[model samples]
Target: MAETVANHILARLREWGVEQVFAYPGDGINGLVAAFGESDNQPRFVQSRHEEMSAFEAVGYAKFSGQVGVCMATSGPGAIHLLNGLYDAKLDHVPVVAVVGQTARSAMGGSYQQEVDLQSLFKDVASEYLVEVNVPEQLPNALDRAIRTALVRRAPTALIIPADLQEEEYSPPEHVFKQVPSSPPAELRSTAVPPEAEIARAAEVLNAGTKVAILVGQGARGAAEEVRQVAEVTGAGVAKALLGKDVLADDLPYVTGSIGLLGTRPSYELMRDCDTLLIVGSSFPYTQFLPDFGQARAVQIDLDPGLIGMRYPTEVNLLGDTRGTLAALLPRLTRKDDRSWRETVEKNVTRWWETVEHQAMLDAKPVNPMRIVWELSQRIPENAIVTSDSGSAANWYARDLRIRGDIRGSLSGNLATMGPGVPYAIGAKFAHPDRPVVALVGDGAMQMNGMAELLTISRYYRLWSDPRCVICVFHNNDLNQVTWELRAMGGEPKFEESQALPEVSYADFAAGIGLDAVTVDHPDQLGPAWERALNADRPAVLDVRCDPEVPPIPPHATWEQMKATAQSVLKGDPNAWHLMVQGAKTKAQELRRGR
Candidate 1:
């Protein structure tokens, strides 16, 4: 049998050392699906419950593995379903390659079944690179460029393959005038660094300030030691962007937790008091949480010239690899003799944790949501990989959980989309099958898509060397994050029709699928439940009934926001009294700890 385009595409993927491709089946890709069996599955085809989950799983795999992730889909609807997750990859700057099937060339202009203009559809999300492979000669070059562009640019790319062409005989590009050939698979390496003069100027800004603050993002993941060295010499306090939550251990006395709306009080204070700022590899968008403009001299170091100096005003913008630039900047900086600023920052961090602990122990109607993450933080393994969905659960994951040791974590950072939490854990499992993984999700997200992915887990969990994968669901029958946003941001009462969720027993569903499961209603049961799930023989689900009225108030809530909440209550919110009581109790913990 002669080779076909579908066979050659898989061969190219194997040459690039891809281990798996997350995808779902359809008639449009029947050629490729058949090729998978013929190839002996060299690069395993990890089937997903839906096309959206396939894209999300690819994002998660890329995030954890530090390699380009690949996802595949059929034409029209399958291609359309990949947009949200592809946008998540684009916004978060994760590298992913999407391989999609299109209608046969014969039926394309005739408006055949599942026919869609995939090029116009994917133009924006895969703006970095997008192409349609017309002939077998286009195979190696097109697929290779897609992978290389995704790796070099850290963005999503796409390749559209017509259904009929995939089953046709393969042909190599000739060494003639119009034909183009690609080089063998290899990673491009470069070390970009700023000039010494600019590095010196940045050093001067840091050395001159009495109170220095450093902000790190996911871009700083590889330069942790350099960040710490710079902080120690400059007497700077470190604040992490949400995406960089695992870059530095919270155990460091000078490391303030996540900064922004889902942020720590100490982080807010760190920005308010600093005289100078150094932003490394972070494009944290909320500028209001940063130092007041013109009040502080700032310097920024980043690998991408496009993103550097855009988030904050900087005296010097060093466009270089974070690890290399920070390593270069270290020698130019002079140590601050006085350590008073560092001492103050550390003191504030200590008090903030105490307040967090106190708040987590507070009483709610059935159970406090913060306690779910707090208990997990206590028992999480040193090498665990944790993922959180976007909702009220993100608040506790940001504030209550402490990241330490070699633990890795991520979510839909820039997009802040829901439903990736569960699939992310599955991707993490494939990336590091020997390590334990956890997903913290809300009921709204679980119902949206998390439950179906559980079947995917049941099929694959036994393949993992370590079988601990826990999905902890915050089972409050409400769209809790938007409910709070309506009151705080829109000054509107909680509209039950849109805000309330229908209750579902996630534990019962998981148990029905032959996985370990538990439901916790009391605060005391949280610890034991987490322990059992984490130590289970297979993947587990934890469904805890949380209080819907508990407010996720921001640490630096403005008077206007407070006024809006008050107005919403007065305007007839259903749980006005319970809201006031829970808010008071939660806030009292911080006030008492401060005193």
Candidate 2:
């Protein structure tokens, strides 16, 4: 029998360094599924219980490995199931290639069973690229374009392949019965560098300012040393966006934690006071948290020109690779010897951390979630990969989990979707089998997606000799973030029942799934629980009972926020008073310290 288009596609996937593709089976994609069955385990297809999880797993794979993630689904609903996770990849600006099956070519126009116009459905989400392979000859071209577009644009791309075309005998433009090559031409990749004039202009703007602040984002991941040097020579303090949290050690005198609602006090102060802002590869959407336009002159560095001034108007825009632009601009800058501004920022960072340490150590009946993040920050392996779900768990992780050198991590990014944590860990573990993986998820998000993906981990987990992956669920039994948001907005938690979750025994569930599990209720057991989770030879779940009332305080609370919180307390909400007191004690104390 002649080779089929599906076989050719699978062969190409393997050659492109894709060892696995997250997928779900359906009648529409039987040809592709059968092709996988004959590939001798090359480009192994990982069967996820849900198509959404498969896409999320693929996103997780790309996030940790810096490679294009691949995911496939059958026609119609299976294709639609991928939209959520694909949106996660699109918003996060990660590379993902989604291969979606379509009904037979003959059935497409007639609207046969499971036939849907996937290209139209995926258009907005796959803004970077989307194509259909209706002809057998279009397979190689579609695959090449989709992969290249995803890699170059750093966004999700999609290919809709009809069942009839997929099963047809593969025939290339130039080949008869020959084996087709899988990988595309190597020269299709290039790195952009900003012009010398642009770099010089950015440096001039930096040199003109006495008090400079640098805002770093995910784009600055590999340029850590250059960023440090730039901060040092320019006497600038660095504040990171949540996605860029791991770029520098939190202990650095000038390094501030995440900026925004989950930001550190030092970061808030940095943005509020800087005379000039040097933004590196961050499109931080919250302009209110940024310095006022006229308050600070700005220079932004980004690979994409469209994003340069979209966040904040800039005096100079440098378009190029982050590391290269910074390296070239360093020499053009006039070094600042004045330590006064740097010292003030460093002092603020110190005080902010001191407050953080206090909160992390605060004794509560139920374990404080921040303490879990703090302990994990201390115990995280040098080569670990960490992920967090959306909600209070993400907020706590953003605030307390300090990133160490060479450690990799991911969150939902611009999409901010929940339930990707466990899938991310599974993907990371597959990418770096020797390294440890950890995921932090909330009770709400855990029930949404973590439970199913945990089973996914259990199936293929034995592939690794040292399968050390920890899934830490903050089992607070409430939609804590939403509850706190209501209070922050001056609404009583009277509707709290709507946001409440049914009690779940995640530890018991994990034990039933063939993994060691532990439940940490008291603060004292927190450290020991983490220790056990980290060392387990199999995947482990640490279900920690954390306080539902502790608010994830904003970096700087406005007068209006204080009023809203006060009103909530006056409304007879059980936990409102405690939350208000916590905020007053921590953020209010920071304000007093500044005074």
Candidate 3:
């Protein structure tokens, strides 16, 4: 006998090493949900408040653990709601396997309630997709391929299982799916690296320049130490894209800052003024911010040949994985002549620290958002997984928190999605419960998709797991800021205009569901409250109060601008919104600075 479509789906997930699959019970997915309730080896199913939250939690798992995160949702609204989370995982290079239930096979194409072109809807965004229609044979192949592609491409994949297929009866024994690796390119192993002369020439130019900077992108993940070696040899500072934050640890003395919109001034100015830029791993998107031929020369190293000249004009193109390229470059490169370059960058950093960072500590009244992230950075174990959502909280943590070991969080570079923090933390903590997890979420994002997962963690606490593995988020009450800011770019911005729940409390809400909760209104109150919540032996939440008027980040920012990130200066035809945005990026109080 064969397994049912739902059973086959469960088996396929197990083969991918998924211990749990996040989902919400629904009509379209009821069969699979029932299968989960019955099976012994079934991935521990986490019933989420909403489907989008499920997807996001899975994204968290995949990104932090480097394993595929599995999520499931029913057809119609549930499946549609997952698009944002799916796109986030895709952009962030998390290997996610999402199973979306559709109407019965007969009703899938037409004449079904809530039927939509899900495959077409998600095709461009998902790395791979399959409309699973059978139990034993088709599901085994389809889901296996989906999982494998997600891992290989380092992006999200999907399996759309129709209701008929899921409910169909079949054999008893399950065949666990196994994906055989396809043949590597013929030249994969034999391809020798380029000559040492190329590296030497690039090194010579790098060493010769008094001011040089390294640019790392998403491509820098595993080559941190190597990049540091290159930085040490070059005596140049480092700047990274948002996605590349973890490529090098935040405290590396050579780091200047991150670059792009909401990027710091030093990186923009340094890259703009510096004589040479070393492009590693990343093919960063914001080419307008990149220095052209007038001020800087670029030497780009990437494994993808197509990416060589796609962004910035390249002075030297080294084609290979960053690790291989850096390893080869290190041996041939000479120690840089400009030993004072790091000192200059460090000086600027120190000035930034005193003027921006220190003043944040002085905020005594409504606890400054900066102080919260900074304090969290100091309080949490360095290696603890720190995830942040969009808007103010995200901007604060990204710029303020110095992320430490085996750490992974959300950074949807250009998209800047909301509701990422809690779900990502859920996934991160679930995958690595031994690792402490903390998420700093805004009231806005918390309301969107994050609040739904409160019970998910609560259930885990019931098992005596490390309750500290998940941080509680009761974000500031301005719960629709991300949607409002995003409206200017795309849709209507009316969420702030009319909030449905004026008196709703996420902490209370979590507690109502048999979880523990805490609340804090002032910024100063946040640190202690969170510390207590984190130290609690079970799942818990802390509601941190923030002023509704405080902006998430400034569009026009300097170094302090990075954490309270700023956008590019607006057009001179400035509007009130732009003026307000500019003001938000400015420091409220500056400490007296001494060089």
For every candidate in turn, the CA RMSD to the true structure comes to: 0.8, 2.4, 5.7
Sequence-dependent TM-score of model 2: 0.96
How far in Å is the alpha carbon of 395 misplaced in model 3? Answer: 1.6
Q: State the displacement of the C-alpha of residue 109, model 2, in Å, after optimal TM-score superposition.
A: 2.8
Report the error of model 2 at residue 42, Å: 1.3
**Cα RMSD of predicted structure 3:** 5.7
Candidate 2, 322: how far from true, in Å?
A: 1.1
State TM-scores per candidate.
Answer: 0.99, 0.96, 0.83
Q: Which candidate should be chosen as best, given TM-score against the real structure?
A: 1
| Residues 1-595 of candidate 1: C-alpha lDDT, one tens digit per residue | 9999999999999999898999998877888988999999868999999999999999999999999899999989999999999999999999999999999988988978899999999999999999999888886999999999999899999999999999999999989887789999997654799999998999999999999999999999999999999999999999999999999999999999999999999999999999999999999999999999998899999888889899888999998989999999998889999999999999999999999888888899799998888889999999999999999989988888899999999989999999999999999999999999999999999999999999999999998999999999999999999999999998899999998888789999999999999999999999999999988999999999989887787879899999999999999999999999999999888888877
Candidate order by decreasing lDDT: 1, 2, 3
Candidate 2 residue runs with Cα over 4 Å from true position: 174-183, 187-189, 588-595
What value of lDDT does candidate 3 attain over all alpha carbons?
0.68
Instruction: Report the lDDT tens digits of candidate 3 across residue range 1-595.
Output: 4567787678656655678888877888988987887687368887777888888888888777777888889987888988888888877666788889888877656767988788887787784554554444454656767777777666788888777778787443344554222222121121335567777777666656677889987777768888888888878878877777777776666675567765655566567667888898786877867776656777888766756767877778887677877888887677866577678777665565454466456443245556677667667776677777776565676566665665555545556786777777888778778767777777666666666677677667554356675454535455434533543333233343553235567778867877667877776576787678668776667766543434444323445434222232232111235434434444453324533
lDDT of each: 0.93, 0.86, 0.68
